[model samples]
Target: MLSLGVRQLDDILGGGVEEGSSVAFVGSIEYDNVILMHQAVLEALKAGKRVLVVDFRQPPSTLLKELRNHGIDYEPFLDDSLTILDGYSNLYGQGIQGGRNVLPNPLDLGITTAIIREALQGDEYDILVIDDVTSQYTLQSSPKIYIKAVVRLVNSVKSLGKTTFVAVCSDVFEKSDLAAILIPFDYVVEVSKGVVEVKRSLQPLRVVEPKFAYMRTRNGISPMKEHYQSLEGLKAQLRAGENGTIWLKDLRVQILEEVTERSLIETVYDFLGPEKGKELLYTWGKKQFIGYGEYSKRHNTSIEEALEDIFKFTIASGGGKLELVELSDSVIIIRGTNLFPSGKGYPYPFHPNYAGSLAQFLTEFTGERWEGEETKCEAMGAEHCEFVLRKVR
Candidate 1:
């Protein structure tokens, strides 16, 4: 458990971030997210741990002066532990050794990577801060590419048992999807006006603080603090999981009695390795469906209608090949095979558009993914017994 500079904030959050999580301080220039992050660093520094601020957003003087004025001896903060990678977003270098700052060219991540790698090699720091990634978001042509690399880098840091947080602003992105995609976050934090709100997925959303809730009641900072309530509400949703994702699929998918739906959707696949975007489609034509007991009064008409809907699409358009060949009548297997269509390759070629979407969906929805070529299988009857390796892909 880690503690923020403020005891209350740390207590509200799960004692700081879970290891290897890319925490985000999603705030813009006016929102004072930088100040909040500084406070977090102050807490870490007070704990006798080193802090590093990868400052692509601001010059050191102003922020250092601000902290000094706050009765903080920021010079020591800057002594050897605190790092300000000022102007690196615009400073393009040939490599880490090439310290020449070429502002005209794009930020050279190759150079930045080497710098970070060398710094990380020394095991002295516990927390790193990348404040306001909007500049980096704008600097990169495709933000996701850079973001994936950054997450890998963060993972490297976490392997050493350190913590890292990136600052992001909602308005920084043209679309929310891109924001969600870019930041590989374990938790999301929003600091608006003066208040800080904390939320976590795979955990709980705790209202750590109401920075401006009181100010709003007295007199709000229109436009600046207008989103205060909204941010708080949005922060509340963090523990809830991915903006309605929790309820978007309140799916009760119990594959009972060895049904087709059970056989198709209940399968599990490994979820590690470089070969991501792999998928094994059981069928691709339409949304899948199932049936109920024929004479059971409890059987609703909708089940049959839904099954009919599933059958309505023919092989040409709907029920394409089930990724797995008929293996032992009851058990079938498929390995992800396509990268573009799905994030991973599927056992069979899927419709180009739907492949990637479905692979990502199943992984998140049902903890499935295609990892290696070899797969282990168990019969529907032998649900407990496993271990038959089959070469896939």
Candidate 2:
């Protein structure tokens, strides 16, 4: 219903960009966050707002033109409402360059911010775009400097009700630090590879906010076709028997330290749908991260060549779905994203479990008896274990 002007993205983000907010685009992701910034600027422009694009990475013209190919219309910017700062950084390691010339080179200032500020000082723009926050973080002095820069730049534009989108991808290298800068923004849109996902980081309106969810690419990268078959309209094949290739167009795999009936398959999806239940299984081998060599030794497998060969597994039909397998009494089994060979009878926690645990860590889920869920203590050579895990849900 709303418009960011980026067709599908606007739909995904639920309307246009919020007036004044900073969206940190994590660079490490296959989808470069900076590219999203460009899209935001183009969106603001289509909304008839003057946009300022400060690019420490590249010239706005080039970047803007690039956006044109990716579904953003830039004719308006060519008509003037958009301004891009070009080559504003001379701070290449041993030197610091301002507007005029290279300085004595202590590298105390982030030239990008200054260029943006000066540009904005003259015009009453409605939206501001910072190509990226990485250059500044890499060149600037400390975290305090970055925070102050972001706060000042963000608040300054916000006072005028102008929306600002700053692309900072290098933040993933330091999550604790990113939390400080990114958590303050009202809306966040991350573009990875071809996937565009949005989250309401700090919503002021509070009407409706988006949560973090998995994004899949269909037509190209990251996003499935709008009219593509619904998740339910698919089949899956987990086992390698009569159902040679079980079509699991919408297969959702889960993992845990110890595969319990609860954690193994918490809920049964509607099997009537084309893609019903296609779950992968694994165990939480150990909580600690010992080196691969040591880990392999502890599990009686070569650190280099380890997989489903050394695990136990079982499959049963549930809700009419074929592959409803569970890894009972196991640990360190790989699942989800194929980070490792994960399946039933495995002896280690799967990728999905690690991911869930990671999510638990990020969201700070409730603390419950996770270790106690499957075992009283680590039963030595025992069988059929059951334990309760305290989770935040």
Candidate 3:
């Protein structure tokens, strides 16, 4: 077993996270669990244990800086005891060369898992920490692939008798998907504003006291006074008010309308031409969904249901009346009447930009790359616009 360096936390677990066992720290937007993972790393290092950090969120430099801010001297463990696999650099299209390994493609689960297993083979690492594992997988691959890879990695590490800590943001994954992923872990810790709730553990447990609170100081996480009387108090603070939520909804509507206007599309296409313009629009559309955050909540729903809700919301907000005319396991057809299409009379298909956006949205929403085409459009003298979507592979 590995000591987390916090007495109360270790006692809660009947020691610390047991060897050959995995623990997941599930957190949300307002409550961060990354700090707890960092503390574990620090504790492991201080105990003279080798640590392997597979970071998919922040850069390695940022992690090092944070360690320094916490008054942890990481200089001694640079290459000998600490090894970092920088996945963030790969996501941004950067090549990091030196002592550390850079994951070239995070989207390929087989490749990513192979690299991780290879790193663990001869390293003799005592602890493995995967930061923001769900976010990394969800952004590039389907939930099925992500869950498989996580289970494989965790089980492999457990067989090697090495402790593993996986951090996941609760807001990024659907409830069912999150529950599925958590099933494999031996322990599940939920971090919120005032409390760190241990929802599951292997050992017989006792009633947890309310005095457990984590405070971050220059020296790292330390025990502090409880901030709230109960978990309900924390939930009350994290919940958004009705007016605040409405204002956010209104703002999103205004921004989407402005960004997806016909004039802006024409200006972009004029400069970049059809191919590059469509590519830019597709990238923008994908990023918008990721940034919006709320779209992820529908991951548990059927693809058709999710798309219907999205189109309904869009139509209500003046995007257009989009009707899902056909839906199947392999194909989808959507007809849009009064869509914000260019009124300019065009002979050929001129909605490549919109088609690109639609393609990206479907891809992210359905967990597959969809080949899309604007079969009929108002620009081409059609009464309504029609889109034919099919799975790419």
Candidate 4:
């Protein structure tokens, strides 16, 4: 069995992929399917297995540079454990003199396959990575020839008891053609709509299931574990427009840009004095929450659920975490941790905005005027921010 470098994926595959099996990482043009393929190659090298990368996306130098960026030690393994076939150069008119094994014409499936099989037949390579099969659309003569070549390669690698990893953009192929390409693989991982789904697995013998979803962030893939259900529900209603707009399909409204706490507070302070700016921000926040409360009332949503949604949105937007500490007939206490550093130098309660919003939301829901005061604040050297709310006489 071989680790794919993603712990969750490895666990889902029942402790990693079975040896000698072929796997495909499939996704649309919106995703970089090659990332996982590169990750797998790095992991294979770490496991001390000799790896052969048939890169169709970039030149050998560029490919090695990328692998090094991923923190792989290159020179030590270059002579023994790692070998890259520069399939990109000659076909792309970069000349064939660039690497140890540069293909004469990668677009020619006959020559390409023969070269690959000869390399794999050697005892030097334990793993094979076709850095992407999607290039077939641009480089191959026809879909029939591409699919045939992929199947032939998979079979040849399997017969040699070597593992294979192939990356392909499913969006480029017709459903029938895509199916033909995937039919030769033992497992498939798919990326779509910001979620990484394991479409197929064999070691555990699992059929289709949502399995899990992941977010591709600037850092890398982050699994949506705790809030997966609610987040997925929200994601389901999101739609992108060709005009560079995003919409909330459920509400039939366009999503707007988010303002950061620092930007909002600092800009307001620059425009107005500290006290006046805080007052204005509080009033603005109160108005927004009142509207949300009205929406909850109109939609028959429970106050608890509405508040949960608000907190989730706040956390998602980098605001912070909020929790209801205590709720009574006469008093309410809300605690906020990891709050945005809004009032850096000011020795006062910085989150007047949130306090006002909560007060107004409760008042709107209960048909009573409410007021809130910040009893503790991180800005004032408190551990967390706390708001105490009470009904007006």
Candidate 1 residue runs with Cα over 4 Å from true position: 69-73, 88-106, 181-183, 193-195, 201-393
List model 2 lDDT by residue over 302-346, tens digit each: 211222211211112221111112323322222222122223543
| TM-score of each predicted structure versus truth | 0.46, 0.47, 0.54, 0.56
Ranking by lDDT: 4, 3, 1, 2
Provide backbone clash counts, one per model: 25, 43, 0, 0
Segments in model 2 whose C-alpha atoms lie over 4 Å from true places: 5-14, 27-29, 59-69, 73-76, 87-115, 170-172, 193-197, 201-222, 225-393
Model 3 lDDT tens row, 278-387: 66765665555552223432322356655655675556445667788999888889888777655657555555545556666777766677767778988778998888
Tens digits of per-residue lDDT, candidate 1, 282-348, equal: 2231123111122211211222332222222222222232233223322223322211122222342
**How far in Å is the alpha carbon of 317 misplaced in model 2?**
28
**Top candidate by lDDT:** 4
lDDT per model, in order? 0.46, 0.44, 0.69, 0.74
lDDT of 4 by residue, 192-219 (tens): 6666667787755322243555655432
Candidate 1 TM-score, true structure as reference? 0.46
User: Which residue runs of candidate 3 sit more than 4 Å off their true CA positions?
Assistant: 94-100, 208-211, 226-393
